[model samples]
Target: MDDRIDVASLGWPAGLVGELDHRRLKAPSVKLRSARAGEHGDVTYCVDLRIRHPNADEYLTSTELHSVEHFLLEGFQRLLPEHFVSVGLMGCQTGFYLGFVNEGRSEVLCACLVRILEEMQAATVVPYANIEQCGNWRNHSLDDAQRVAREILARREHWLDAA
Candidate 1:
């Protein structure tokens, strides 16, 4: 397993998140998973993110939104522009929402999600100081955070191609 992941092959043809910030739109409160009965099925390829913030309300903060906004502009907008549907921060918890362009595309999306999780598992830690400032899931080191983000980006390319 390569410890350092290289995302130079997304075919994005540009730097991630650099030039695409203004085109993002927020899709508030999407019902992705269901705690209720009879609300599950056919969930395949998807980018289901489970955000873990200390204070759920802090998700409303510009910092948190900026993090997600950067992701949307960087990865989703460039890779899966046609399949992108909605992005909502989950209202019930520190989680978020993701709806694709088609239910049929769930299989590939699930694979990308799994790849992201795997890369995150392999990541080292970001220092505490930066974490305190960034307020991500933890005060992980920059390397760790960038690793995870790169995983997301790389898998995004994989998902786009597979879909």
Candidate 2:
């Protein structure tokens, strides 16, 4: 069976496609997963932070995950207002999937992640966690989100190491 993915065929840049192919051969790790052109000619990228490796027995608590979601959504919008699309929690509770529209460069995305993490670390409260903005306002923890943000920021240098 042919396992190779023709990322360029999917409208990804050749340089990024090469990098993605390299990462695919390595063990699972925290990094950007893939990039492809949207039907509307926009590009969408998936970021895998892997806060908890699949092999690990631990997972993020619901409250922490919820808070992190809130922080990321607000931070991304503030920092990458033109490109940010959405943010979603990984079902495994290990990390998140960040969606950005029309941005395909891994380096740029990685840098944005760093900025978001820095903002998250300094955040005093979870944005949009109030009754008017959140569906589950009661489920959130700024402390937990900050802690995770700190941990991830400390390892920022290795975010692109997967490639």
Candidate 3:
């Protein structure tokens, strides 16, 4: 029985395909999850955004994660209005699952993520971090979000390396 998963057939971007191939030949590591093509010809991707540093915090704090989620939702929509679908936080709090309508280019998505992080770093307040817009509005932290965004941006080269 072959346990290997054929990622190429799933319409993943080249980088993710190569990463999966490498993982198959070696030990398992973080990498993009999957991409599914909708009946309407749209592609939705489940991409991972894990932090791999050994000494650093393994997962984002709740406040940081929430703030980052808000920032990403706003940024992705503003930057990729036509393609952006939604951003959902991972249960483990290490990263997020970013959904897109038709966009499949990993590089473009990575670039957009970088831009979003940059915006987060410079943001003075968290959008929708209010009682009217958020259920736990008072639980957000812009400072922690900015710090985590800065850390992630500093390791931008490895953004594609998923878990």
Candidate 4:
């Protein structure tokens, strides 16, 4: 068996990444959360999502971890789901993650993000906050999450460079 990580074969998990990619189907239903003027010329909004497994136990509670995910998701959804490019959980951090490669200007993404933040503040239900934080963020450390984000970001950078 090949020990090497097959970067070429990797696709963002369909449930999360792939599901969001079908923007056309979702766009109409996606509500605009907020708006702002532009600050940066090229940046997209980001969202975090957390889905707890049915097998959660006492040791697996990480409000901070789940909080970040809730922060991202509600924030982005309320702000700008259209500018979304990529969505995924960090390979390491419980749910520490980012949304990268936005389609338009940073200013646009920021405006949307502001709306998202507001929505987050108003949200009543947060998915993963109650779950036990036993899993090591997909079983890795913070360093691992950073590395994963960097690698994924770089890959998108390469794709943009190619285009």
Write down the TM-score of every candidate.
Answer: 0.35, 0.77, 0.77, 0.33
- Candidate 3 lDDT at 23 equals 27
Q: Please identify model 1 stretches exceeding 4 Å from their true place.
A: 1-48, 53-62, 111-163
Write the residue-wise lDDT of candidate 3 on 32-55 in tens digits: 566666666666666656643322
Local accuracy of candidate 2 as per-residue lDDT tens digits, 22-50: 32422223455566665566666666656
Q: What is the C-alpha RMSD of each candidate to the true structure, in Å?
A: 16.3, 5.1, 5.4, 15.6
Clash totals, every prediction: 12, 0, 4, 13
Alpha carbon deviation, residue 76, candidate 4 (Å)? 2.2
lDDT of 1 at 99: 55
| Off by more than 4 A, model 4 | 1-61, 87-97, 100-104, 127-163
RMSD of 1: 16.3
**What is the C-alpha RMSD, rounded to one decimal, of candidate 2?**
5.1
Candidate 3 least-lDDT 10 residues: 21-30
Q: Which is the leading candidate under lDDT?
A: 2
Candidate 4, residue 137: how far the Cα is off, in Å: 14
True lDDT of residue 4, candidate 1: 28
Model 4, TM vs. native: 0.33
Ranking by lDDT: 2, 3, 1, 4
lDDT of 2 at 4: 44
lDDT of 2: 0.69
TM-score, model 3 to reference: 0.77
